[model samples]
Target chain A: MAKQFGLLARFKDTPDLFHAAEKVRDAGYRKWDTFAPLPIHGLPAAQGLGRSRVPVFTLIGGFCGFWIGLLMVWYMNLYDYPLLVGGMPFFSPIFPFPIAYELTILLAAFGTLIGMFVMNTLPQHYHPLFNSEQFLATSSDQFMIAIESSDPQFNTEATRLFLEEIGGTDIQVIEE
Target chain B: MATTTSNLPTCPAQAELLDQIRPAEHKETPLVGNKRDFPWVTEKICTIVESRVPTWWWVAFAMALFTASFTGVGLVWLVSTGVGVWGLANPVNWGWAIVNFVFWIGIGHAGTLISAILCLLKQGWRTSINRAAEAMTIFAVVCAGIFPLFHVGRVWFAWWLFPIPNSNAIWPQFRSPLEWDVFAVSTYGTVSALFWYMGMIPDLGTLRDRATLVLRRGMDETLTPLQRKVQTAIWTLRKYGYGIFAMGWRNAGNHWRNYEMAYLLLAGLSTPLVLSVHTIVSFDFAVSIIPGWHTTIFPPYFVAGAIFSGFGMVLTLMLPLRALYGFHDLITQRHIDNMCKICLGTGCIVGYAYIMEFFIAWYGANPFEEFAFINRAFGQYAWAYWIMFSCNVFVPQLFWFKAVRRNAAMVWIMSILINVGMWFERFVITVTSLANDFLPTSWGYYSPTIVDIFTFFGTFGLFSVLFLLFLKVLPIMPMGEVKFVMPQADPHGHGFGDTAQGANSEMKGGAH
Candidate 1:
């Protein structure tokens, strides 16, 4: 809590926070974010954020899992040590489909969890925002906007005025 | 109507809020009763975890712990003596162990159905109950895994089910249905846990915040005892403990964007995952060419029965907890009604599956199949068959009446009966089929030994203990998701919501 990290502003409610988000996006501030207790529908678009890249990871994991499951069956049964049982073909995909399918789901879930962590860069352990006691309420019953001082358009006085003009209350400079 | 319209405020936002609030032709029951607000939802759910344990909680926990100890001692004795202590004979090599396995795993389906399937369907009511239900799913799976692992007779060597390539260099039969079960149950356990924990993160943060707010004094000044000083130490642990597991969740919009995406994807993956688990489990019997088990309909039937039994278990757990905790607002009557309807619906499917099995046996004209069906209904195990039929089939039919469905006491009884019926259903399916097969000389009746009975009985204890711990430690309901379903959670709406706030305000003073 030494250097000014950003300008923090609290909004009255969701609609107010949502509108403020639109203004902040229009203001073209890149190093900024909005916080809410729960996911607000259409907030991402209002905040000028695109869809998440998590699905790509899930698909990649599923593809790898399916092939891995299938090949493992083949390797174990036919390549490594072939054994004859019930006069069935040694490496038939039909017999081993359940194993592969289960793996596909297993790995796909792994991918989704891993991908989400990667996308969010989570387990951050620390952030400048945590220093602001008022900001902690964002996890429960409050909505807030934080525009980082590192933004290219960082003017301390102007940014403070801009936030005040947008119906923000309890405006504070979060120190990092 | 004109006066009502004109009395509405001149503000357009206020007007739109009224229309949305009005009861239209498609009137639906209130999802959350008593009009609970966001903060109220968080406080109500979190305080249960934060406050001093109630006296009844201790009583219930002690009983569950006592019951679970039977399983612990039974398993130790089982491993020591060998699998022979159970009622294994010439025909019934597979006994109560397999029956309990299927029963426990089948009960887990409802949780997945509520959390994953209902989430996919956009069923908003699921928000209030999904967290507990998902926890039930994970715990039920743990109980289910024990029987199969130990029934292998060499519990220590259970790791051999997986293809880790030990010194033997030999591989498991990749084509075996039992092998498929190893993957399905393990994967189901892992993914269900992952889903349950992921959903809990935000709710955990809610708990963490409240716990962190006042570490010197416990959450409730009035409720804190002399032991509250001790609770402060626990609070310090909670702040960092829930903090670390909360994964630094600040409820930032960017994090939620990715989090929601992952949630939807997991739900998508879990749908097929849940369906496949029981399907593969059914294959363990169906592919084996056993007379009763060799049907094409086993997968769908098993899945339906699983859902039916799962919902029954949900009602069994939630109804008592709801009444004890005074969660009428959060877990409204509509929630109970809806679960009754699901139980009724799936119970019908199970009944139909039962009839269809018999129909196919007669229709197919195979002597073994015909004998299996007749013997199932009228054989030495006729008593079990009647129990499964009456409870699984006949008892649920009572839910067709609105009176029965709405009656909490009656529904609770039905839920218990439904569980009993389902357990017997599995017992009948596993034992009857194996007991009196093709050979008359080899056929013999299976009776569970003391160890077998105690082992199966112990699972209920194990399930209750885990659930009781969950009730005490975690936010039993998903507060964030429940808040998500409230009208005020809508982004475009004026904040106080139109529901009761606008209407009540306007009603108090017309022409505002």
Candidate 2:
């Protein structure tokens, strides 16, 4: 049997898309998403999506990098070889600040990148969303809402009518 | 009220009727063109990458390649012969190589200033120029990294600079600025490469999609086996390559939210790095005991000069290309004017630093420092010093005139002069301080050998080659970011409905 993908609706503009998102959220559809060419302000709130947790990952990465820098410098400079030059002391907090600061930033940047990918579940080369011919316009100048067929309340005919009522145009069923 | 009405030239009802007929016009200048719409932007920018390479691009590429090969030749000769092939002797051991290193590193600063700093400040003009500038930064650093790596003389043993466990268990000196430089430049290069690649991801998706369209159209009436195979290969490569990089960016609200957050944080992280990287580079000289090199003001002075030189190089590259590519709409007169203003401001700061160095040398009453300043202006290397002053200080002052800044030819000429002046500035700092050190007997006049000259020229070739190649491969402008600044980008804006209707029609027409 051919798998049922979802119902995809194209909106003419963002206001229409926002209103559609409100209706869909009110309809309590869990497995759905909105797409646009650029990030629309307040769209996430309109759909009632939860906040992302990438910042927490960044914080942890920063602290770990800070300690790694401090310890690496200490072990190498003081504990391991301890060659005294310019009559300066073996170990000091002041000397390692530059390396520590650099590491903190480097690790935090990596964390942000990794956390974003992890949270989004990206590098998804193939998705049912890509199966639609018109769906490519979502990355360009179009706004779209896709409610997966896997949603608990999804009905083939009823969902199409509901999308039309909410001002979605050119509604189509996506198949996998 | 009756008297006011009687004094009016026309009746109030008549005036009200006229006002209703003609609405007030708000004549604000757009950042780009008035006719620039979403499809126009996507088509225009992508076409640059999709089209065949132009004749001028080939000519430039050939020149860049010819010059860049000198680096290989020079390096091979340097490795076969010892460090003695070039000029490095008694007191003036730190010579042209160090000067070039500092010079190239300084040239890399403007990219970060445009991409990261201006981004934080919400400067929309940076969108058109940042991609190219960032590429330049990465390439310039590659050129800069070469000098220091070879300067250690035994290129094979350069790994000792890092803290890897060894049989001898000897560690690199942590307190030294040189060690800090090793970390700073490497970290800078890594972060810059990551940032550049991250920004290129969305544009890569556009290219991929465009390739798919072309492939699909070609597949409809394909003829030969060879053409079929080539088309399939090209399509597959673009699809997989873009797929991996773009990471499924659908411009979903949640994806953008996280992406924007990450981008902003990275910008914040890189801001301090801009100040820190050059400051540490400055410390290489300031921490020294040499009279002219050692100073409290070196950090800010070096930072200002770096920005000055960086902007100079940016203008030198951007002006000609902008004219040739007809990017005037995207990179407007205002953008050029703003960059010129920054160059002028930083140049003045550099000029002030020159004056203050002299003042401090006299005011502090340090004989070595006093002689160092006097010797720079009227000593054996006085010609170089005066050239630096004239180019760095005098040339930029031309920009104070509106006519000069607006004139592309004049700006280009001044930009080249500023770049030359900055190189000479580094040369004067490095050679002068070491040549006229405290001991008269140890002091010697330093001059570059043919090898030194070739090596330095080779680095420029290397930088140009990388940048030119980059221009061909990537979308030199950020199409996604540019869209954000467009008037029609806002969904709820007036006339958005009309714009959408036009876009829909255009999409439908293009689909067929």
Candidate 3:
């Protein structure tokens, strides 16, 4: 463990943690977060986070996939050594609809996956929160709120006191 | 009573009438076990993966391994000798290979239907069974994929199906239905695998965290050299492997927001696939000009049968599993009943399609089509046709009786019957139509060689081996999703109050 990273406080349940989030938000701290074992219905609004951008990525991916499917079919059948088999036209749009539709879905699904990881900045190998043994409870049944040292208003003493005042227990100073 | 309506019995009579007319409470059972807490859910599901293997598991695994090896041997013999080893010949070019391919692929459909379709509809009962079903989907597809690849005879040249650039400028036929099948099946496989893994991440984190706790507690204890090495390996792999797959999931608000969106998008994407994949597969037959194969109704009929067979396979696997592992609490009788209901509904649709096919054949006024239908019922393959009818159409009707659906043994037997009936359904469609076609001279009897029989049986072995391995290695149930549905998981509920105190008592309770 390195030097002091932040003050990590554990909450007994979601309501206590949710209330503490409101308090933290009202206090004007920017670099703090709350963790729970499952998604709390109102936690995002409580933390002031906005709508996710994954849908936008999916839209763009669908359009690209559609065009790619069209081009691949057209190029193979119409442009490259067109040996006509059936009496139908070489680049009939009607025939390619199935492949095009499938590609649209396939790429859109990939976009959602990639966009999520990029947006969340995931595959993060380590974090100071992992250093707090109590913080592991966030993945199971406990809720936690961590105020990082990087936050503008963070003070080792003042943050600890604020957390204690808000019904937060097992407050520990996490080390990097 | 009428004379004093205003004064005597107005209030009391109305209240009594309302009570009588009101529907009963319905008393729907819980999907999971009663009185289950957060830790209990996690412990119950994860313990299956962590505990010592039972004797039955060993016996089943050995049987699966033996069959899987037979599949390998079958494939080797297939590639070494040629497609000649099978009963495929003039006029009847397609045989057990195509039948098994369609059968396995149809079986794979239920998994996606359970996970994606039911999920989108907010069918809460799906939470208990979707994880295992999705795993089944992935494995069944693997078994399904082998047939087409080896059926091409020159297995080495199977890559010609794809549009990749090559030294030879010859491209695959753009309008071929076979080409469309390649894309549809491959995309289905990839998407299913991704969906299954994405769902497993949180549960994998639970396992990883649990293993970490055990490791830390045992650090001071003495151990034999072998035990020490084993523990060290498990610790290292669990830490790194799970760490990467979990993608730093801390259930933070932002993470949850993104995860939910991604999951929903994937489900939306997969829903269409559940319909489209089999529809395209049907095109491989319907687009042809053969008498029995050229019907306009193939797509919808195929989809219905796919779902029917898929549910049958789910029941066949889940019923035995629920009994063996004592997962009745999680996989309740209600779940079994619901699945049986789906099977029955789809089976009825399939039966109607059968009747419609015969009607259309006679109504169309084509001699070949009429003869094809007549031959199917009265010809040499009539036995297979009747088997398909009884097993698929008649057997599932038993589910109408609540007693039959609730009886695990009865359901198990019916599921096996449905599976056999479905396989015969495909066999009937493929063999009967092709065996007796336009010219009488081209008509021949199609009997599957021993190789064909072994190869089909081998795929079942492969499917079971993969499923059994999945059971031992991963959380067969989705603990994270299961927890979400439990009463205690509610943020505002008393469950959290108990959880809070429990957290205080054990500092690391959250980690568990």
Candidate 4:
């Protein structure tokens, strides 16, 4: 038989896809993924994806915004020009609080949006997962797991045995 | 393939149902008795609209409107005739005008806070009355604007507040508290208008669909053409308007994520305005060397008082509105519970401020400050002070009990009481303190003339007229948001999954 580049395994149910993907991962194959119409919990671990770092980015953005506001206040009222109103300090932190709060939030939001876009590697026109018609079920109602031949551990006989052991049904191999 | 095909059979059927085109013949008339058991929502909603305003609502609005318009018409006469027609004397420059200004502005706060703040927290109960509350905010702000504009006496020169370099080559004093007022109020109006419009767009589409030919024609003129106008409008909106604002929403895809971002942004934006607006308003009092006004606690105190009065007004508006509009489901006991909690919290803060003011007056050991507090409670104008205490402090205490908080009738009564109390609190601050300043010889009693009273009335009338118009025009609830918040619409744990994967995969991979 001709060598296939990818093995496709449809799930008995959504949960089966996750279990099969987990087995594939434990078998030490990295070039494997699980796809479903909706997000399946714990599938990220099954697919070797890590947790997000967007929150840290947001915190940094917020900090930057706070300092920027403080800097503006200092520039406008203290360094650039100074006016004494009611004998209060030129760079009063009390009045600067609202501006600082606003800027912090603004920066945090911008960071979140940008961070999300950058992390997701989005706006791409094409993906390998889009190649198979059977895989189109990933956008509708079915769950599917695909293990590419790119994996170091992916041998045709061994992968087929691994998928069948983990409750994968309607399995097939595909090539480019 | 050993997979059972039975479970998968339904998918194709659903897909066929989705793709099947309904004939236009049945479009104009929905099958009348298709689901005979489903209670008639159309009739119910119509009955709600035609129902008389609750007796209490009319009485309350009439009384409040009388007072509001009295103050309003009084200001008009002040402008038309002269400021001298009113009771503002020297040293006591800020009088009922300041009192009304603060009072109305304070009432405005609860509306936005209820709408935006509660929405952010996912307190779903806010949907029903948020429209009315937002409308109240706009109206109260308008009423608040009248006093300050006429306070200058030369009302026509209001344009000078703008940053217009004039023939006199004069620019507004950027440092002045009044100038800050100009900025705060205008910014607030613009932001509120945008928020309100954004909220109304989807509901407006819903209303457009259900409207009669005349109403449809009217809405179509502004929105789009009639016939298939609403369908076209909604489709376009769902495709484009929601395309951008929806933030990569696909169906209910990432609905909550987008809402969370937009809502967080709004809350983050408005929270500052809440603090800044009142702080700037307080500056008008503080910049003056009035011993009582020149206190550091003024900002927090004013903010607390604004929130206190604002929630009070919201309760006052909501109690009747739910009954009138048949919105009991949307504005539930839980919403009232939260609002009552706010009122209780803010009331305590105001009460604490009152105590702190007296303590500080004694601590400062300044006779002017001491006498101001003393005279406020025990002097000739002590009536206003007691009314403030009883209304602001004592009345809100009823909310401590779950029963009282949940009880609509009692909520209405307390809300009105709080409004009265807040108004009197402003009265005590503006009139009593200014009237009895450091110089005993310069001290004078300031009673509002009929013109002052009339201007106040006219303002209430104006507010009511505007409110009535709003009811007729806009959808009272945000329909799009309602669909978004429903349990069926929640796709992922946080509405961030495949939708996020497609649009934001690059960002999600970032190391930071």
Candidate 5:
């Protein structure tokens, strides 16, 4: 961690982040990030963060929810004291479907929310990213780009030359 | 350098000019770390839009109050005297009460339909109209609910509708269609209310951000303190809301997939419920061996009619109200066009149902059914039949043209006429069939008495009063959602082109 050199490139705004990122990537920097006061339109593509794995969790959640709903209805209607009227069949799926579908959705939704919170490492106590005072402006107005020095191709002189050539402003080294 | 930057003027003369013409300022509560000196809202704008309620709004509200009181008075007389006073005789047992109930409930379908359905379609137009429509849905459902509760003369025994069996040792006969109705209507009420409130939470937070101190205080009292603790309450809500209301909206990239899936599920669920509800209502007639009521097509036919009439009611309320409230930009010509298209489609479905019913009566070679259909067209209730025909079929035909569809006044008038036509259609269906069923000896003409008339009118009064109150208190539109829908919010275009200024700049090669 101490020996590795990271690339640092800052964008004055979100668009600058996008264009600068494309240039940096073309120049062969593998790992990087763009940050602004809010989510930027093209930053994710610039970071090369591929499609997320959130849906796999959601599907599993949905399946579990379906079975749980079925069991709840079964216990209440068939297991408990059964009362039948008008000769309608007991434990009819048509009648129970609304409640079942609602519960299935309820559980699945809960699972997805929890999964996202876990994956994002939310409620962080501390972050090395916060150590830079200039970075504090990212929460207010300025937009920034940080390319970790740890990438295989990262060389202090080469990366600094590359970032400056591509119109990056306020380049700096961020420590771990 | 830092001191110089701090000394820079907050707004130049040009920026102040821009602010004068187009108001822009953050009006949210001061957070612990806010660096800005003064908040955005000017004293004048706050005084006009957010000050004490104006007199005219109050006057209109009072009139609605008077109408509701009259309805209450009518109900008191109805309970004390009996069902006998208001035209529920032998052949015509169902009258104005059931008619209004079905009308109001049917009216509610449009709101949920617009919010849930269009959101799935990824239509940007929904942002403006969806907020008010959802509010209208809740109020209309409330209005519709009153009729069924009051229709049962023994109003005290309404609790019997629930599954709970008391000392009587009698379980509510699960086979009865009305019992299904109790579950369906109540469940619909619960889900719709939850969905509406969930949708409103973000908008309420937006209002919290934009509101004056007085308005903020009012909102604070309404929302739990815990709900207000976060600055990005609206953002957090959407993050979770898209999960809960949208049924686990993970895989942010596959937005279309999740949105489409959730929509299809809800649509599938609701379509059947829509069919089942009216079908059960029709079963009240169909299960009985009465000649006019024994048709199998009653379920789908009735459901189509319900959707038709419901859309009509929505257009009637939405068209004029949007104009009155200065929401024309949000509820645009395009929305009106889409609604008109649906109205025409459903209107045709209803027209087809009318024809099919007559054809079935002929095909079955049943004398009783034949006579019932013939009488509905040519007998004592012929006026209602023609009124239904003209409004449901003829008036809506104008929607086939783009010009008529886009014309606000024409569409508004047509929508009202369609509602009138729908009421007559229900009245015609319930009354004309029941009266003169098989035996001429029991045949009778049904007419609504003063109580029946007032009770139905009272429902309108109740619906208007609730809706007006909603406008005054809540953000009439979902502000946070509109902001999120802005091009600035979406990080990826995915497929569709972006719509906000931030996105526009990318197109023109400018600011991010």
Candidate 6:
């Protein structure tokens, strides 16, 4: 038999989900989360999460791309093999501006994707939550709150009762 | 859970009181119709992919595949023979190949404009159409790439355009406008693809779950054994296919937080990137000393024209799909009206550029420049020029009327004509200037061979084939994003406060 993973509770709709998350948060549980079909605007705040850390990665990638584009052009046109075209200078930022500018955007986009994947630790491809039939609805219509057994606050019976108290229906102790 | 009707003004006097306070103008057009909910939105979009192949899709796919074969034949012949197989000549060296390239690349811009620019501007309407539009951008870029790649004569030597350490000792010439185009087009394609895929992750998860749930819930007694077997096979394939790409998206709070931020950052990067693509494409001409192509207005003019043609292409693809899918509610009339307005605005800009170019030619008083402008409108290629003017400039003027804008059939026709006009636009610019250059002895009238004509037409077939496959497999709308904009998604909205059911639900998040 699969070991018990956590207690999963179903909320009726977005408002029910939102309020349940707030109650769960204030109740001092750490290893818990609310899942829904679409992003609720204030759910992150309710869940005690702050601003995402993706921008720093984007900034870093942009700077590197900008410099790399500029230097690559300089090396190719000026330093590596010098040539003159239409009596234009060996290189000017003006001519290579498009390349550098494009690279800035290109790498910045790459950074955002990378940062997101890293922050989310995605391509995980497996989690205990995947085992629950009810939890599958998170991407479609269902809204849910799951409290992991690993949390210090977890007690199967107590968590089930708490979830029910907070207007959660169909509470179940899902297993991995 | 049950705040369905009580939140509304139930009686006339109650409605009158509510209306007195509710600003009539404050009511934004609903993004979705029939007061849809999350599950319905997901089901509506997902079923398009999950449903058995429709008859029309089969018919369209057959035509697209048949048409795509011409491109395959043309390319094989071009490469096996030489560049001279086509109608490209000494004077008009850049002929239909360059014209088609610019036209297709111009069509690619609307996708990014809708996905990136509109997203940044908080235009909730973009959510319904952005998925298909982004797919169009990708397929259009693929078609755009084929021309320049084969136009180099030896398609094998195309790798030399990249700044890589190859057996060939030299690197790409960074100073060339063509080289700039390489980076610009490739970057735009990559970012647009990334944005499209990332945006679809949540929706892919939705499909994945549908496969799991539907498969688990056994079918009705109506299905035969063979039918059940086939359905099971498809569901299994879809489960793994979507599940793999979905990357185990849980719709968890932490995931959405980062996903949205990443999306915003990408949109920010793409806005400037989309503008830069056409601007750089314009530089390909403006940097050259050609009389017609040397104007400073080329960048802005080209961008506006690209947007006009892109919106035109969007309408061409969307009008049919929306009607076929019965997606009238999702793709509302407001979306069509908004797109028409954009076309009219940009068409005026393109027309102004056309007239302004002639004015500049007269103002500069250069005989060569003057001849180029005169030749475009009144010389050997006058027919092409007039076609461009009428289609791009004159036809789109119909959009100025609200009635015409609301009429999807009229708008669809205008959109196709806009596409045709823009194609001729590139033709007039590329051919007329080269056909009658400063030296008379080198001047020659350019016309495409059957190979050139077939290759260009084949691209449409290829685009349709790709898009058809996309429609058959992928969720065609950004279901997650669409739902995000619905009034019900707002936790602080009327449904969440001051109602009996809202109180029953204990909506504490609204307090935050």
Top model by lDDT, which number? Answer: 6
- What is the per-residue lDDT of model 3 for residues B248-342, given as tens digits with 9 covering 90 to 100? 76666678778777888888999998799999989989989999999989999999999999999999999989989988889988899899999
State residue B293's C-alpha deviation in candidate 4, in Å.
Answer: 0.9
Better of 1 and 4 by TM-score: 1
lDDT digits (tens) for residues B1-512 of candidate 5: 00112344456985676556732343432111111111111121122334456776798799989888878988898899987767788778888877887777677777766776666666666665676777877887788787788788888888877656566755454445566566666656655665565455333322322332222234454556775554235434433332233332111212222222333344334444445556666766677677777878887777777777777877887787666665554566777787888889989988998888899999999888899899999999999999999999888899999999988889889988988988888788788988877788988998999989888888778888987787665556654344334333333322123332343444321232
* Residue B463, candidate 1: alpha-carbon lDDT: 92
Model 5, A30-120: lDDT tens per residue?
6655554333444445555544455555567668866765665555455654666456666666655544554555455445544444444
- Model 6 RMSD to the real structure? 5.3
Candidate achieving the largest DockQ: 6
- Tens-place lDDT per residue, model 3, A29-139, is 998888877766666777777778988888888888888988989998889857687787888888888888888888888888887887777877677777666777566
lDDT of 2 by residue, B408-491 (tens): 999999999999999999999999999998988887999988888889998888898898888877889888787766655544
Q: Which run of 10 residues does model 6 chain B get worst, by summed lDDT?
A: B503-512
lDDT, candidate 6, at B130? 97
Pairs in steric clash, model 2: none
lDDT (Cα, 0-100) at B387 in candidate 5: 95
| Pairs of residues at least 3 apart in sequence or in different chains that clash in candidate 3 | A137-B510, A137-B511
Q: How far is each candidate from the true structure, as Cα RMSD in Å?
A: 5.1, 6.4, 6.6, 14.0, 12.6, 5.3
Identify the leading candidate in terms of TM-score.
1
Query: What TM-score would you report for chain A in candidate 4?
Result: 0.78
The reply for model 1, stretches above 4 Å from the true place, is: B1-26, B216-231, B494-512
lDDT of 4 by residue, B369-455 (tens): 898889999998888899999999999999999989878899999999999999998888888778888789888888887776777
Worst lDDT 10-window in candidate 5 chain B: B32-41
DockQ score of each predicted structure, in the order shown: 0.51, 0.37, 0.39, 0.04, 0.09, 0.57
True contacts kept of 2: 0.42
Stronger candidate by TM-score (1 vs 5): 1
Tens digits of per-residue lDDT for model 4 on A1-176? 65566888776443455556666767787776665433343456555555555555667777997888667666666775577777878777766554555566556655655554444443332344444555543332345778889888888888888888888767888765
Residue-level lDDT of model 6, residues B401-490, one tens digit each, is: 999988888989999999999999999999999899889988898989999988998999999999999999898998878988776677
TM-score of each: 0.93, 0.91, 0.91, 0.63, 0.67, 0.93
Model 2's alpha-carbon lDDT is 0.82
By TM-score rank, best first, the candidates go 1, 6, 3, 2, 5, 4
Ranking by lDDT: 6, 1, 3, 2, 4, 5
